[model samples]
Target: MTLFFLNILLAVIWATLWNSFTLLTLAGGFALGFAALWLARGLLAPHYFRAVPAVLALAGFFIVELVKSCILVARDCIAPRPNIHPAIVRMPLDVRSDAEIFLLANLITLTPGTLTLDVAADRSFLLIHAIYATDEAALVAELKAGMEHRVRKVFGT
Candidate 1:
């Protein structure tokens, strides 16, 4: 994912350095950046390009979840009576690396009404704060089904 982003940034830098903002120039820069990465394949990790598809899918998943969460939060704000049932729950994680764990935590925090508090010392669990969670089990299941599952796919774990 960082490679993907660096590629984009390199493209922008390409355009900026050349003082050409045209779409054609941007595309050319992107192609050149891709070629640069391809040439360094032997020097870099083998799985660099393979993770692009999963990263794109993860991005799409995040957008969908963000929209859904925003609507839910908006409804709560618009309603005549408040129906917020806040809770903190420890969510199990299959992710081991610090990067993957941090990404999961950030994604959870970005979603409305959900905040990641801490990761367990063992890194097997994530403690999250949610504004509306009447049924703790259901909330945990929803999170596991939604965010946790997508995150696992993101890291190919």
Candidate 2:
């Protein structure tokens, strides 16, 4: 967390030095700060550096999933006979914290053809409504391996 704050400070300083407080300039500063921190990572706690890549990977993975979902949903909509096999699947939860669960639920809901219906009262699982859940087991496995796994990484859980 300290490293994160330091990075942000560096970015702000860079923005001030450049005499432009625009988003682009700030982002460029952040990138440079990240590079500097990464290079000097041996002096700092290792986890923070690892987290940067993990967050980036999660973002990239989410974007890919979002695009694929959009395409699939669009195709189903355009078809004379849509092939979707909708189902509400109970996905067992590995993420325990409220923040983790909240993020996972929101990400699932943000996808094109999926919605997070409800979380189990015990917080042991999530009820997900999927538009293409012909194979419920596969859907659960995919979510477990993909989004849940990435969320865990981001939180270091």
Candidate 3:
């Protein structure tokens, strides 16, 4: 946590030194600060170093999935004969913490064709409505492997 704050402080200082506080400047400063922190990883919590990359990876994965889903949705909308096979699937959850479950559910809902309908009271499964769920088992497996896995990685759960 301290390292994260320090990284933000470094970004602010870098912007101040340049007399420019644009978003790009701040982002550049952040990248430089992240590099500096990486160099000093021996002096900090090793978990923090691992977490930063995991979070970035999750973000990257989400972006790719979002784009792919958007394209698929758009194609279906424009098709003469739309082939969407929508279904509500019950996906067994492997992520245990409330925060992890919340993040995973929200990510699934944010994507184009999928919406998280509800989580089981026991938090052991999620009800997901997906536009492309021709095979419920495959859809569940894909989500478990993709978003759920990334969420677990990010939270270290």
Name the top lDDT candidate.
2
Model 3: per-residue Cα lDDT at residue 30: 88
lDDT of 1 at 32: 89
RMSD of each: 3.5, 1.8, 1.5
Residue 136 in candidate 3 has what lDDT? Answer: 93
Q: Report the error of model 1 at residue 39, Å.
A: 10
Candidate 1: stretches off by over 4 Å: 1-19, 22-46
lDDT sort, best first: 2, 3, 1
TM-score of 3: 0.91
lDDT of each: 0.85, 0.95, 0.93
The C-alpha TM-scores of every prediction are 0.74, 0.90, 0.91
Q: Write the residue-wise lDDT of candidate 2 on 31-130 in tens digits.
A: 9999999899889888998788889999999999999999999999999999999999999999999999999999999999999999999999999999
Q: Which rank order by TM-score, best down to worst?
A: 3, 2, 1
Off by over 4 Å in 2: 22-24, 39-45
- List runs of model 3 lying over 4 Å from the truth: none
What is the Å distance of residue 153 in model 1 from its true position? 2.7
User: Of 1 and 3, which scores higher on lDDT?
Assistant: 3
| Candidate 3 RMSD to the real structure | 1.5
